[model samples]
Target chain A: MKANKVLINTLAIAITFMTLVPFVWMVSASFMHQGEANQFPPRLFPETFSLEHYLRLFISMNIVRYFLNSVLLSASITGLSLLVNSMAGFAFAKFHFPGKESLFKLLLAAMIIPAQVTMLPLFLMMNQLGLINSYFGVIIPGMASIFGIFLIRQYISSLPDSLIEAARLDGATDFQIYWRIVLPLAKPILVTLGLFTFMGTWNDFMWPLIIMTRESMYTLPVAMANLSGEHSQDTELMMAGAVITVLPVIIVFLALQRFYIEGIMLGSVKE
Target chain B: MKGKRLFKVWMSPALFLAPALLLIAVFFFIPVVVSFLMSFTDFDIYSLADSSNARFVGLENYKNLLSDPLFWKAMHNTLYFVFIGVPLSLFVSLGTALLLNSKLIRFMSLFRLAYFLPVVTTLVAVAVVWRYIYHPSFGLVNYLLSLIGVSGVDWLGNPNWAMPALILMAVWKNFGYNMIIFIAGLQNIPPELYESAQIDGAGRWQELLHITIPMLMPTTIFVSIITIIGYFQLFAEPYVMTQGGPMNATLSIVLLMYQEGFRWWRMGYSAALAFVLFLILFAATLIQLHLQKRFSTV
Candidate 1:
């Protein structure tokens, strides 16, 4: 029995190392000088740590522009999506309307249809609208989503309706009730959904790859992909790029892990 | 005053819902129909310039895709991924969840963070990092293997090892997600069931087999379905790491569609590929649901 306990603990330690080694190596390798990572024995740590590649990334690569673009896009998509999806989610939760059930059912059914099916024609439509190679091409499609509405609606429905009713009896406009009461009360779910949207938009690769054709407009992920193609030989340089692209989302995730993990449970249970 | 209130009540939902509804209609629903229509026509670069140039070649793209060797290889590779990757991921996820759930382990949060850190990071960035990790001679994986007397294997360079390399990386990236779900499911299982099993003198292994596995069925089904659907669309990893291979070993269905539509401008074929992906997922979900209904006495 004692041996079994030791065995289990050792297993945990081993798997944890296996899980974390790549990230540790990436960070370590990013600090290594050029040609240093190709050591025969495979150095796990940089012997002489340097910031030269990071300097090159900033001065020569203009990665700051891509970084700003990613931040700008993620924040906008989160804010807009929160507003649009919440309004719709609020209506479904508190208000009655004709065709509401069928409409929601239709929306739910549409979830099963993969977004890839829509991309080809969606690209054509973007071209027709002259939104191609523009941030709006990415933003407009993401401004509202079915899953976002469904998530917000589920949470909002669980809140007591008496609050909205009292606000209404006191002559509060529906918008006022939504903006004032529902918004504050629904803050947790909003944070959860907002984190989801922010992280999703930050890490998204394919749509940005399609829409943002201009080098100046590329998100961090798209820019990194482009770099990997051209600078495939520069291990240290590419590792620095990966660290830059990955570090922000990691910080966000760790900072807001409670809300993020809450979102995960809600996703599983709510669905 | 009452009339005004009634008017506001009636018009409010319309105002609240219209913008989102309109956007979804234009961007999502209409585009789905447009793609379906385009799949019937021979839409290429020519038609992309002028609508009149597209020939309504009914079912031709689907017929051609059905017989195309590359499409079949992609289909086979995708199925191979789904079949092997889904269960392997679940196994790892459940293993980690069980380990983390054990009372013997401390620092559960730290362990969880380590496991899940890969999941939230950008896939392209990690794929790039993993590309170097799978390097022929200087890689950590090869070096570690050498210690155990297994000589270096060309991971990304060999067709046989390429898909498995991508799968291992994918599994590493993904298992933490399902692990979280499984942990939740494990916690929700009634402690009374375990207590009763122990009172009946059941050993740990027997209790786990009879009680834990049986109780976790619904969660297992949910995780597997989502995992299958998500794994079916494998693009970014192979794109960043192998570029669909040392010889097309890692080319997936969506990757093929991306190449056909984006690279070659063959919109009709790509649209058809999209529909086919949708059909496959629908069939997969239905099969899972049917199996659930058949076996689930609860």
Candidate 2:
């Protein structure tokens, strides 16, 4: 039994290391100076690490612009999506509309209709609105997702109605009740949903790749794909770009992982 | 009294739902309808320059799609991806979940975090990293293969290996998510069942086969459905890694749509492609649900 336990522990360690090697290699390769990572035998560590690639990215590649665009776009989308989705989610959960159940059911069923189905018409719509090649193009369609609303509604529905009733008796307005009573009560789900929106907007590639035609408006992943096209042979530099694109998400997930993981579990359990 | 209360409820729900519903209708629903309409007409580069140039092509684009060998290639590639990728990911997720859920496992949190880190990372960046890892001459993958006397195969450049490579990366990136779900499913299984099996002189393998597998079926089915749906929509990886290239071996349905719609501005044809994909996904989802119902009834 003791031998079996040791073997199992060893296997777990091996698997963990295997899982981490790709990310570790990405980080390590990013630190290597140009030409350092391309050596035979695949150097696990750079002989003399330098920040030159990162410097080059910000100075030569105008990556700072792309980085800022990503940050600003992700922030705006997250904030606006949270506000819109939470209101909708709260209504679905707590309010008793004539078609509340049916509407909610429709949204749930519509979830399976992949977002790709809308891309063509959405692009035309954006073009018509003059939002194409603008940040608003990427931000508009994503401002309120059915999934976000569903997630929030599922969490908020469990909140006690007594709280809202007491607030109403105090002559608090519906908006006030939502702001003071419901929003605060649903903080955990809000954070989780917010993280989902932020990460999703940040990581999104294809939509931005389509809509954001101008180089200046490009988000990180879109910019990175463009950069890769131009600099595919620049392995070390490409690694630096990948690191920049992936690092913020990795950091955010590490920081708020409890909520993120909980969100996934929540989604799964409800199904 | 009931009328007044009903009115109040209606007003509140309307107020709450207005923003999200409006966004969905304007952005999602309207576009989907317009795209469907556009697919019936010949909306292409000529139409872009002058809307008057567009004409009703009827089934011309759909007919072209059927004859277009590229479209068939994409269909085959996407089907291959879904058929192979889904089960492989499910198996890996289940295996990892069982391992992590084992009582003897130590440092479970650390292991869980390690496995899950890939899922949350940006796909474009991960694709970029994997692109490097697949480099024929000097990549880590090739280097590792060399140690075992295996010649370095051009992973992305080769038509035969490109889809499989993408599938491998996808599975690596996604399995952790379902693994987390599977872990939850595993934990919910009653320990008494395992104990009773053990009391019957069953070994660990028998207990797992008899108890754990049966109990986890519902979770597995749900996971498989979602995974299949997600895999069918493959785009960014091929767009970034292969550009659906080396003979169009990696062109997925969404990638095909993107090319026709955005790259070539064949909006009408692209919309039809999108609808076809939707039909396929809807059919698959219904089939899974029906199977689940049948199994539960039995």
Candidate 3:
């Protein structure tokens, strides 16, 4: 049993190291001078440190513009979707109307329809509206997501009805009750859902890749893909690009991982 | 006063729901319907240039898709990924979860965070890093192999190895996600079941086989379905790392759809491919549910 415990501990540490190796290598290679990353026997660490690639990315490549674009896009989507979906989620949780149950069920059923099905027509629709190659094309479709609505609705429903009733007795209007009582009390799910939306939009590749056709409008992931295409041989430069692209989301996730992980659990558990 | 108050109550929910519901309707619902329609029509660049140029080509796209060798290749490649990758990924996730649940493991949360770090990183970055890591001549993988007196395999350049290379990276990127879910599942298992098994002289493996595995079946099913759906849509890794190359060994359905629609402007055919993928996912989900109902230990 002692030997078995030792073996388990060893395997656990080994797997953890192995899991982190790719990320470790990514950060390490980003600081290597050009061609050092590809050396035979693969120098695990740079013999001499360099920042040539990061300088190239920020100075000449002008990656800051793409970085800001990603940040602004993700932030806008997260903020807008939260407001819109939360209103709907609040109503679904507390209000009643004809066909309310049916409508909610329909929305739930629609979740299975993959977003790819809507991409073609949505692109064409955006083109007709002259929204293509701009943030509008991305943000308009992102203003509401069914999963966001469902998650918020699930959390809000679990809140006691007495709070809303008390708010109503205090002559709080419907909007005021939601804006004041519901939103604050539901802050945990809001953060969880917010992190979900933010990380999703930040890491999103496909929609932005399709809509943001111009180089100036490219998000970091789209820009990263273009860079990798144009500079496949420049391994060090690409690693630097990869590092900066991944860093912001990684930082956000690490800072709020409790909310993030709980959000996943909430999503997986059936309502 | 009663009527006025009733009207206000009626309007409240509608007002709350309108913006979100309208956006879903216009952007999501309408597009889904239009895409289904567009699949039957030959919607191409000329049609985009002038709507009058488009013509309905019912079943032609689907017909051609059935006969298309590349589509079959894409299908074959995707199934290879789903069939082989899903089980392997689940195994890794479950194994790590079990290890983490062990009392012997210290700093379990730190290890969990390390494992999950890849899941939250952008796939584009991960794929690009992996592209270099799979380099035949000077990659870390080959370098490590050389230490074992093994020859370096051309991971991404060789047709036979490219898909496997991709699968390994994908499993690495995704396993942590399901591992967390599995860990959650394991915590939900009643300890008494294990204790009872121990009292019955059941060993560790026997306890796991009898109690833990059966207890975690629901979570396993849910994780499998979610993983299958996500894995079926494999695109970014191949797009960055392989470009679906080395004889198109890693061409996925979505990658093919993107290439056909956006790159080639074959929107109608692309929509058809997308629909076929949806049908497959729907069937896969239903089949899993059916199997769970039949065999559910819970």
Candidate 4:
């Protein structure tokens, strides 16, 4: 019994180390001087830690522009989606309206239809709207999502109805009830949805790859992809670029993980 | 006063729902319908430039897709990924979940967090990192292999090895997600059942095989179905890492669709490919549901 316990612990620690090795190498290699990563029997640690690669990424590769673009685009999507999805979610949860049940059901069914189905037409539509290569091109389609609305709806439904009713009885308008009562109460889910939207928009590759034609408009993922093709030899620099692209989402995820995990469970549990 | 109140009641919901509903209709539903219609037409670059150039050629794209070897290769590759990747991922996920759930483990959340870190990181970035890790000469993987007297093999460069390489990276990146789900499922299994089994002389293996697997069947089904669906849409890994190269060994169905749609401007053909993929996913889900029902009845 003791032997078995020892084996399990040893295996767990080994696997954890193996799992984290790539990320550790990514961070370490990003700080190494150029060409140092290409050495045989690859060095896990940088001999002399330097920020040259990071500096080059900002100055030479212009990764700062892509970083800023990702931040602006992701933040806009998150903010707008929170507002749009919360309103829809709140209405679905609290309002008595005609076609409410049917509409919500239709939206639920639509979730199965993969987003790729709409990508072609969305690109064309954006082209016609002259939104291609514009920030709005990326931001517009993501302003509201079915999953976002569904998540908010699930979270908002669990709140006590008496709260909304009391507010309503006190002469609060529908919007006022949502703004003053539901918003504060739904703060946990709002943060969850906000993190999800922000991370999703930031990590988005295909849509932005299709829509954003100009290099100047590219998000960090797209820019990194383009860089990989052009600068395949610069492993350290690419690592630095990867670090820049992935760090913000990791921070956001780590901070709000409780809400994030709760949201996942809420999403998975069939009502 | 009653009429005014009714008007306000009716308008409030509409006002609240208008923005989200309109966006979904215009950007999601309408585009889905348009894309489906587009599959029936010859909507190429010329059509894109001038709407008049597009002609309705019903079923032709799907027919061509049936005859296309590249499409079959893509299908084969995707199935290989789903079949192999799903099992491997589930094994790792289930294993880690069981380990973390073990009474002997300390700091379970820390271990869980470490494993899940890869799932949240940017795929494009991780794919780029893995590209280097698969580097023939100086890669961490090859270096480790060389330590055991196994000469370095070109992971991504060799056609035969490319898909497996991708599958490995994918499993590493994904197993954490299903691990969390499996942990929840594991927790739901009552400890009393285990205690009774222990008292009844049921060995660990027997108890696990009989008790744990059967109890976690529903969660297992859910995880596998989602994992299969997600794997079918493999794009970024190959796009960033291989570009579906080394003789198109890593060319996933979605990647093929992407090339035809965006890169080559065969929009109609690509839309057909998209529909084919959708149908496949739909059918797969139905089969799993059927299997789950059958298994539960037994």
Instruction: State TM-scores per candidate.
Output: 0.97, 0.97, 0.98, 0.97
lDDT of 2 by residue, B177-260 (tens): 999999999999998998888889998889888889998988888899999999999999999999998899999999999998
- Full-model lDDT for every candidate: 0.92, 0.90, 0.92, 0.91
lDDT of 3 by residue, B121-200 (tens): 99998899999999899788999999999999999989899998999999999999999999999999988888888889
The C-alpha interface RMSD of every prediction is: 1.2, 1.0, 0.9, 1.0
lDDT of 1 at A214: 93
- Enumerate residue pairs that collide in model 1: none
Summarize candidate 3's per-residue lDDT along A187-214 as a digit string, tens digits: 9999999999999999999999999989
How do the residues A1-271 of candidate 2 rate in per-residue lDDT, one tens digit apiece?
A: 8998998889888888877888888889989988888878999988888899999998988899999999999999999999999999989888876777888888888988888989887877787789988988988888989999989989988999898899989999989988989999899999998998899899988899998889988999999898888899998898999999999999999999999999998887544
Give DockQ: model 1.
0.78
Candidate 1 lDDT tens digits, A94-153? 898667899899998788788889999999999999998888999999998999999999
Off by over 4 Å in 3: B1-7, B295-298
Ordering by lDDT: 1, 3, 4, 2
**For all the candidates, what are their Cα RMSDs to the real structure?**
1.7, 1.5, 1.4, 1.5
- DockQ for candidate 2, please give it: 0.83
Best by DockQ: 3
- DockQ-wise, the better of 1 and 2 is 2
Share of native interface contacts present in candidate 1: 0.77
